[model samples]
Target chain A: MEVIALKKLKVFLAIASSALILGGCGLGNLSSRPSSNNGTQLTGHANNSNYQSVIKHGHYLTSKSRGVDVQQDANQLNLKSFENGLLDLSKKEFPTNKYIFQEGQHISTKTTEHWLDRKSQNSQGLNPSGKETKVPLYLQQMDEQDFLTQHGKHLKLSGMTVGLGINSIYYYKKKKYGPTYKKSISNATVKAEGHKIGAKVLARLRRKPGLKHIPIVIGLYRQGSDDSLVGGNFFAYSVNKGSSIDGWKPIDERNYVFPSNSGDKGKHANDANDFSNFKSRVQNFFPNLSGVTAQAHYINGSLSGMHVNITTQFYSQTEIIAFTQYLQTAAKKYLPSGMPIDITVKSTEGVQSFLARKSGSKSFSAHVFNSY
Target chain B: MEVIALKKLKVFLAIASSALILGGCGLGNLSSRPSSNNGTQLTGHANNSNYQSVIKHGHYLTSKSRGVDVQQDANQLNLKSFENGLLDLSKKEFPTNKYIFQEGQHISTKTTEHWLDRKSQNSQGLNPSGKETKVPLYLQQMDEQDFLTQHGKHLKLSGMTVGLGINSIYYYKKKKYGPTYKKSISNATVKAEGHKIGAKVLARLRRKPGLKHIPIVIGLYRQGSDDSLVGGNFFAYSVNKGSSIDGWKPIDERNYVFPSNSGDKGKHANDANDFSNFKSRVQNFFPNLSGVTAQAHYINGSLSGMHVNITTQFYSQTEIIAFTQYLQTAAKKYLPSGMPIDITVKSTEGVQSFLARKSGSKSFSAHVFNSY
Candidate 1:
């Protein structure tokens, strides 16, 4: 069952986000099913020929226990329908999660924007500057397979996962923008949240029982900015009839996030400036000031908040206020949008804190920092 | 605290193998330690700032019970020495397994040749003919960490793992050969063997416990052939003093073979050909001829033996003998050497089996397949 092994590799690679696209290597195709040299589907592989090593490795449950047909061809035949059924079932189970097919789904502008927001939140670090592309990602059916071995006496185990492709989102984003759209968030958070959502999906899918003894697995996958499946996370569910949905045991889930698309632009282009860069940028405003330091807090990838400390030889309260105002304006000029910036101005007498950020409108807001 | 999250991510990324090298990414460097702005290492991190999220995620144990210095810098200071100690300890324990260091160790030419032989066996498909760089990877102390929470009143658990960078092997093969090499062994088998050795190492480490309640974990890692580390298998160990080493519980181990390397040259070259490809290659040699199929058995990464089934349309005994001889030569041509290749030329009349492999010296031997 090299195919089974490939299936496992595919799953693992998909989950590990950083796995190179297994294509282009002379090692044959890994993403799709293993094909014969002549390009024909291996429809009639001998029993366990494709899975013997995997079985020996104890990664898959055998069909020997029951009269189940775990043949690849047979499974492939039902894979689509089963996945669709699972997707529909998932939608029915957790509609708030916004599950949908990568194709054949129409969403509202609000829904798209919400996904964009989540996507932005998921991203971290600096992104290329361009037009903002607002792409919506939704849940869609993905690959499935039987388990390495049977469950209990009458139970058979099979599982499938889902993916969130950004192809359509990219299309939407590109269409909304001119050539490209600045992805608001960093690439790192998208991966972290993708894995979380995947596990969450798996936990949710555990409750749905279309087949007896076959435990279901659910996960989240996202296409890289390149439209390749670069990020995914998955979990397997063990069934318990008497227990609640939460009682289902989740198998090992990958914690790593896959890389996003290469060409994908982000909304926050200046995200490259972290604590260090911000410190220097702030220093540029006060060239002669010797003691100036900045600490930026990155929640996902973007700066959520920052603390800038500056020491001056001497300054009165009014002078400090004026300097703080000028600094607020200057800080706003360089910092990424929506981030809270706190400035600590220190004198020989005392230290004062100024909090600066965007107000409800386009105006900037600055005030004295309070303990609360 | 978020730095701790970054630390966990770094550890997980490093451990997962296939996890993208978080280098150059805006997500912050994860593998070593987190340095502050101006490239100065952040020394005075707040309590729980490094381990809070990891503890919340239940990934590591806090050193609350015993006075264990679980801080990254302290741990790092001991990392190289600790790893060296473990490697020496492992070598002393499992002499037959032949563990060597990537550097700073002298071994005999025989040992180097033995490793080269094993390395050749581990490699399959088309190995470009060239000078072989025989590097014997010895036991070296590797990444270690404190365990996930304390086990009991006195037991403070800690563990370590080793990685064999197959990047060199992949490079040697790619330079000597073309794009592909026959990967005779299954990823599953490689994974199984890796865990077995990992457990063996753990068992050996358990014998030298300086502390009664301190449990040690051991495992192996290989960067994927694509150097993406997408294919990584790992196992965790839980120690009990009274029980036999085998009795020790092994946490779940991944059953995926880390790819050799990919086009990233030594780092990203796709290494996908395994036992399945060998089987397929053998199968392809007899595609049009019905009843002509072969089964190749691999141990670790070498071909141990093969079972070839041949059905005759019309052939004499002499013809059968020639076909068997040709098949053996072809098998030898593709499969890793020093292993036996068995061919069973069958017909409706009777079955004739032939086994071919290298003999004591330059001679090759052939015999009828027998039970003995």
Candidate 2:
């Protein structure tokens, strides 16, 4: 058994030695052959040269278009060569230059300055020299007609223009011509010794014919504090009696009123008797004023202190101005002689313009100033 | 018409005076009144003493239970009304104390002592005073059993004691064992080299049945490295052959082998032929040693540079010890000279115990070392 083992061992040794010699000569092709094919295949020399030229052309175009100087040593090609070589490059470097060209044509011209000057002349009613120039009465009429055509639905006025003239110069005022004035008054008694009495007046005027420049004023006041004259006066003029300028006139007492202490205690007494005298004087001008009512609120639980509200209305601008002037004259007769009362005369014309000009879609204008 | 108007004016004046007096007295009450309920019906006491007392009691309970002190001041009470108030206060005053509680609970008493003594025992076994004495073999066996119970699925050997011993006490020597050692020659048939060759021999003796102690020496050697018998010896041992001491005996070549140079070159003329001669020697010692295989691998790409791997199963403890001694000797002979080589001869008992003790959910102690 030992001898057989020895022979077998000798045979194994000879085989192992030969295998080693063969392996050393690089016959072991098992693990390295597949790695060489990892790179992309090339079609031919033509494809390679085409790809190079395309890339060179793309670089040249980009540099020239951007106004950058291409280096002298760099290769440059014409547009034709660029187009031919573009397809041969790798998809990653493909040149995509898409340009559109068209031929030019001619047309006539008109400048904006001509139109602007015409509009300026039309809007001013006079040239830069300030003469009493007319843009032909018919043209003026046409302009007004156009304005009415464009903005009539938005206009809150009664389309009446009242003309007021001081000597020959005419000041044209427009007021809304709509419903007749409405009035309501309060009559509840107050216990306070001195209470504030307030009145709200609503009035409207209708456009009248043939009155080229009709001037009118409106006012409100306590009866005994003033005479037959109105306590305050608001002024307006009509250029055309019945035109686009006429509309429903609104009197906003909070604004337009002149500053004065007309409502103070000593000058305008708060006694029920004094209020009765004031009411008579107000009614003398506004004969149709009615539905008067009154109420009083105690100040800090004191019956001796109260405030009152009285509301009334006038039928027309003529009546409003007539009543206000009567109150002014009457107040000069009865109240404390030197009491500087503030008579705020807000024109129905001004208020109507304010309400009419405001766009219906806008809740309030950005330019409006709040008084309260 | 004029007479009717005059009568209306007189009536309006009568009503206006009454409204003015009421308004001046401030009796108006339109917008200020609460519509839902009377003023007296909504009255309630503003004092909150009951709420204050309840909050105080809550503060006291929270502070006492959580080891915090509650301040009696009003401002402190106000601040502590929030949810994290006490926690925020404790962090501000006693930050480090938080870690104290965690550290005290995490470590066991024994582990704490282990950490304190680990540095002192790192270079040597135990202190001379025996404060850190070697754990008794019985204790080590118990520890192994407990480890098996807790983490048996992870352990590589089951039902075996892993005793810790000093490195200096183990020894290695060289000599030959059985016939399977000659199989190292077959590996030369394949050009495969760099294979590691290993062998083992074991013997269980029944000397005089009841002998209290018997000294046995084992030796392993390559075929022609040394002339003197003692000089060729690779491992030696002396132990009691009786059960009066401990029932088990285990020696690991990893702890016992002493290195030497012998088979740095092949034993036979062909050099590569030494692999078969070595295998023949191993087979001679264990006749039933089945599953023996030999493989060859290239060492440094040369035919003469050959290595062999030999594996055989062992049945008994004596066989395992004898086998380990044989391998120690062969490794000393054939392994390259002047280099430190690691040769491991673990007990079959150790391996079996390790396998059986493994836990499906647990991993080996190697993980612990790697983590460190």
Candidate 3:
């Protein structure tokens, strides 16, 4: 349910670009921070309590960092993917049942702001400076989430994650309210700069007494532009050893917008066709459909999940229920297996029905909203 | 507008009871608070940047208190009305152009917790002492908003508003996993106790150094039960001078669920018939509608706004556009004048279209969501 709620928060866009990294929070000057006890903190949560709450988001204390991501990124989809994708990756290391999670407290807001700026005489920024057209500061924003372990009455920090949001296209102006120029960041350059920044980040962070030895997982994310339909993806990440990251693991995550003529769907041609068949089946079953669309996800060029959205002309709960039931049949017949897929039905009024099928589930579960 | 966004945040309920108060934040132990510079602060905004951002909702600095009300009051609709209605009432006195608003920062969480508890054992709650069901605590939660004015480069607190959320029905359990009992709070008791609590709150708040001389507006709110279809409303509020709330003004706010069989229709019979006629016209024009419903808001027993939701069975955008046009005509012919009304058209997918017309506007403006 939280997955769907978070999905609603992202702005619907068209397909764009991506690249990657993921990491969490580490130790900080504990006394300088505000009390972290404002929200409901949980330890050893029930196995089935996977739902997200502000205090504990599936074993992570989220610190209510919901809206700040878009401040620099300017793309809602990029913000969602950057935040949620990093969490998904963090789970591989910090198992929900084995460890507790909290928002990054060690990395101060000032630190992130300073890190994003281009290096200058007055500031120590991560991005290379004095070459505006050459370097063009790719790093936009950074977020940290800390993993902790229970030690008596206190939860001791064990590991952390760091997400680096890089710009796919840089926009700048020579004067205030003047015409803005754009520069596209190539995949090769993004990878190079992102790695350079990550290495420097590790070296600087290692000097802090609290962060000296703890491993840090850094993720490099290439952001989508404001008009982009698809959110950016994590391209590369490195699981560290002591103060050094031995190697960067290539994270090949891709998205295909359904009903596309985009030629890049080479290996994913079958997945695209399957999505097309699913859309047609649902549309054929309900001829009154206004429009049907989907954004399919793939990992290493293999299908993983599909999120479908349908907008309708009617405001009927009974119709929504019947259509959703029919959709489950179409999805089972035409969609990929081994991962969860979801569909949302809507009319001019609002969300009418939601259907989702988990990987292990045989059938889809549906919810039809009551309209009074 | 923020009005509709706030409405969506509320859970759809089936007529609920309500009551009132409204206020804002003032000065605190200034030095101890976190830096309020995290958000994009605006001093004198444009004539119309009415859309809501996390840092600012309309002219108010929201402090991201979006999901906290349900912590104390389980009903989501009550949370929306309790927060938004307080701002609406405060706007009458504060006026957006002259004063800027921010979330209540002065009343610490600890203060509100102590204030809401039933008076006893290390608690100085406003609610009276242990009499069990005979004197159940009515006070649920309190929120404040601060209004500020620019004084050269500095912004000074000009005044404040406070909102009191009261329980309409109290539910409690004696032991863990035990049967829960409900106690109904009568209007007479709600009024007497609310007034008494309001006066005491003023007396206590005036003692704080930062609050002594400033004017305060308090709105008393009655929260609806979880299953109620309609949101709660503010029943009464008072404008204070110095330490005293001069005289309370009864805010006669009411909501009517259309096509109800409940005999309370009386004088509203004609208005009800008008609504039914409008529904019939739309249904006759488009036989595929799933359902049409309206929540008519009245101030001083006169219709001020009608939020109509029509769910449809068709997923056709063309049909939605045409039906919305037909709806505009029907609305103009049947609905009351001098107040803004909005209609949302949705199916199971999500919001398909939104149609709204300001009070002075003669026709409704429509938006059809892009299905892709």
lDDT of 3 at A249: 92
User: Which tens-of-lDDT digit does each residue in B33-65 have in candidate 3?
Assistant: 122222122322213212111122212232322
lDDT of 2: 0.19
Ranking by DockQ: 3, 1, 2
TM-score of each: 0.21, 0.12, 0.46
Native contacts recovered by model 3: 0.02
**TM-score (chain B) for model 2?**
0.19
Number of the top-ranking candidate, with DockQ as the measure: 3
Model 3 vs. true fold: TM: 0.46
Q: Candidate 1 at B260: error in angstroms? A: 21
**Model 2 agreement with the true structure over A1-372: per-residue lDDT tens digits:** 211111001111112211111111121222211111111110011111211110010011011111111111011111111111111111112221111000000000111112112234544221112222322110000000000001211211112111110011111113345432312112111101001100000011222222223222111111111111111111121122332332223212111111113464432234333445544544532444452212211112221211111233322222232333333433333322321222222221111001101112212111100000
Give the root-mean-square deviation of each candidate in angstroms: 26.8, 48.6, 27.2
Considering summed lDDT, which 10 consecutive residues are worst modelled in model 3 chain A? A1-10
Worst 10 residues of 1 chain B by lDDT: B40-49
In CAPRI terms, model 2 is classed as incorrect
Model 3 bad stretches (over 4 Å): A1-372, B1-40, B43-72, B131-134, B174-180
Q: Give each candidate's interface RMSD in Å.
A: 28.0, 49.9, 24.0
